[model samples]
Target: MNRILLQLAGLFSALSLSAFGGGKVVLPSMHQAAVGEYHWMTSQQFVDLFSISMAAPGPSMMVVTLVGLKACMPYGTVAAILGALVATFAMFVPSSVLVYFAGNWWDHWKESPWRHAVMDAIMPISTGLILAATWIISKTSIHTVPTAILGVIALLLMLFTKINPVLMMAAAGAISWVFLS
Candidate 1:
């Protein structure tokens, strides 16, 4: 038990340091580690937890708390929580220091061709990850043509309508419980 916890802690810690361009950018790696490598949760579970975390307060990184809780019990939660904190600190501290001291340099670099080239290199990687996460969610949530249609319609409606996302999700849940179940 302790060994697995320690391993998970180390894995998450390393992942934290590797995360770039905020949480979404490194999400695919995190998903791979947690869902594929660790078998801590299913892809659907990750999607559900992500939704729940987003709907709640605080940073979207709260998904780490959910993952930690799911991975073990109190100890797992502690380790995961600490892992998240360490990850955030590891990323933030350097950034904060850089911004504090080298703010103008960073701003100047933004206009450099190298900055554009770096953005170009990273854009596809980030997009691919986001697409993979979407595919994983779709695989679980849209098992049938009707459900797929529902999802598409829900997506379009959210994009076009003023309806609250929380309300839409609730409605979808009710409909699923009624027809799909």
Candidate 2:
């Protein structure tokens, strides 16, 4: 239990620091660590957790807490709670501190040409990371033909339409419940 808790702390802390744009940017790495390296959960379980975290009101990075809970579940309830707390703290604190300091520095350099150049470079990098995360999640979630179709439709809607995403998500859920269930 101690070993697992420490591992969770280390993993989340590292991931939090590297989360350039947001939690979504580190999804691929999180998936790899939790599903591939640690075997804390299956790929499907990671995807399910990701969906839950996204649907929840708080930060999407709450997936780290879920992962820690799942990882420590075999130990017992107390351990699970501890794991969740440790992971959440480790995941949020360090990056938050960095952001605080970096934000101040960024403001200080508001008119610097290098700041603008760096921001421009980050845009493409962040986009690439987000695309990789999307690909990884889609690969795990879209196994069946109907699911694939639904995903494509959702993508198109997101790209081209002004429809509310929550509505689209609810509609997709209903469609899946009716047709795919």
Candidate 3:
């Protein structure tokens, strides 16, 4: 139990620090660590947790709590809760501190030409990271034909239409419940 908590702390702290743009940017790494390296859960379980976290009100990074919970479930409920707390704290605190300091520094450099150049350079990297995350999630989630079609439709709607995403999600859920189930 202690070992699992330690691993959760280590993994989330590292991932939190490396999350460049946001939690989504580190989804691939998180998936790799939780599903591939640690054997905490399967890829499907990770995807399910991701979906749950995204659907929740807070930050999408809350998936770390689910990861930790699943990882320590074999130990007991108390252990699982502890794991969730540990992972969530580790995932938020270090990066938050870094962001606090960096934000201060960024504001201090507001007038610098180098700041603009840095921002420009970061744009592509952030976009690529987000794309990679999207690709990873798509690969894991879009296994069946119905899922594929739904994904494409959702992508098109998101890209080209002004439809509210919550409505889309609700529609998709209804469609899946009616047709896929």
Candidate 4:
């Protein structure tokens, strides 16, 4: 009981620190660990939770809370709730402090010669991580032809147009309901 909770705490806390761009950027590794290594949830369940987090009002990192609850489900709802809270706190707190201080330091160092070099060096890595996350999500969610088409269209729209993402998402939902369902 205590062991499981502690493990959940440790996993999310470590993941939080690695979230360079945002929570979404960490999804690929998080997915690998939660689904492949830990056996906390299925690939489908993970995608579903990710969708829920995306649709929710807050940051997509809320997926950690759902993951924690799902992982602790066998123990009991109380255990699950505790897992959710612990994971959420672990995911949010420490990295936030780092960001706060780092942001200040970055502004102070804005004129440093190595500042641009360091940021430039890390740009590719950050972009690669985000692309990896996209691949993982697309691989999991594109089980159907319509879905694949929809994703392509959404990507094209995102790339080419000035459309609001919310509207595009709603359009995709409507199209899916009309055609896929």
Candidate 5:
């Protein structure tokens, strides 16, 4: 009820603030919170939700909406939608507002040498965060040899080819449905 919605709001809000690199960067912690600390979902469910989110997405962080919905499943669908909306707002609005203001301030300082220096310094950290997120997703996702093969194929396709990502997604799904499963 009220308690669950509040918890969702708090958890997403905290994650929103911490999403320095991107929504993906927060997956590990969000997974721990939803699957571990709150006991709201099993690890398998968390992994499944993430897979679902990536497959059907406006944004990668749509996983938050899935998490929220799953959290309130015992309630009716309306409650579940409310839970999703609340978590989505918590995850997006606060960080967006901060970025908006920060963008304004940053523009004013855009010409400063120190600004470029700061960006250069932070690039490595951002890259590292993204790499860590990749590892986290890989560990959660590559549950079997076939899935790992699919992951490697997808990675190679992305890195070296001009193949459409949607096509890759479909190929992976087809492979999984036909073989991996």
Candidate 6:
């Protein structure tokens, strides 16, 4: 139990801190921790949980909390929540403090060549991580030809159509149950 809690906390903390844009950006890290590193969940399970988390009303950050709960119950949930909070704080506080003190200078530095170079360096790494995550999730999720077709259709729908994802997920799930199963 303690091990589970610690792992949950550590995983959440790592993703939370590493995330540059927001919770969506951390999905790869969360996937890695849960599916790849710890083997706490299968890739399909992780994808399903991600779907459920997105379908829920609150922020995507809640996905970590849900994953923790699924991993080890109440204690793991607490640790996950705390880990996210701590990790967010660790990233936020320093920037906030720096901004508070260096307001104009911070803005100026943001436009500097060095900053641009840093961003260029970071982009590829982030893209690679997201790609790896996509690969992993796809390998785990596309077990059958029908499922693969569903995934492709879902991707196309998400990319080209204006349909809500929750509805698509429901439709896909229903189709899977009725036809694939």
Show the lowest summed lDDT stretch of 10 residues, model 4.
52-61
TM-score of every model?
Answer: 0.70, 0.93, 0.92, 0.90, 0.90, 0.69
> Any residue pairs clashing in model 5, and if so which?
none
Alpha-carbon runs more than 4 Å astray in model 5: none
**Candidate that would win on TM-score:** 2
On a 0 to 1 TM-score scale, where does candidate 3 land against the true structure? Answer: 0.92
Worst 10 residues of 2 by lDDT: 52-61
Ranking by TM-score: 2, 3, 5, 4, 1, 6
Q: Which has the higher lDDT value, candidate number 3 or candidate number 6?
A: 3
| Model 1 C-alpha lDDT versus the unseen true structure | 0.69
Q: How accurate is candidate 4 locally (lDDT)?
A: 0.86
Write one digit per residue (lDDT tens) for candidate 3, span 1-181: 8888899899899988887677788888889998899899999899989888877778767998999999999999998999999999999999989978889788768889998798798778889999998998888899999999999999999999999776787789899999988
Q: Give the Cα RMSD of candidate 3.
A: 1.6
- As a whole number from 0 to 100, the lDDT of residue 105 in candidate 4 is 82
Candidate 5 structure, TM-score to reference? 0.90
Candidate 5, 90-166: lDDT as tens digits: 99999999988898788779878998788787778778877876787678778788888889889999999999777
Candidate 1 lDDT over residue span 32-149, tens digit each: 7779987878888987887787677777656766666566644555665665554445434554565578776887887789988888887887787668767766776678987887
Q: What is the C-alpha lDDT of each candidate?
A: 0.69, 0.90, 0.88, 0.86, 0.86, 0.70
Q: By summed lDDT, which 10 consecutive residues of candidate 1 come out lowest?
A: 86-95
Q: Give lDDT: candidate 4, residue 126.
A: 83
Give candidate 6 regions above 4 Å deviation.
24-29, 35-39, 42-44, 74-105
Supply candidate 5's per-residue lDDT for 34.
Answer: 89
Task: Put down candidate 2 lDDT per residue, 1-181, tens digits, no spaces.
Answer: 8999889999999998988878889889989999999899999999999887877778777999899999999999998999999989999999999978888788768878898798898889889999999999998999999999999999899999998776787889899999988
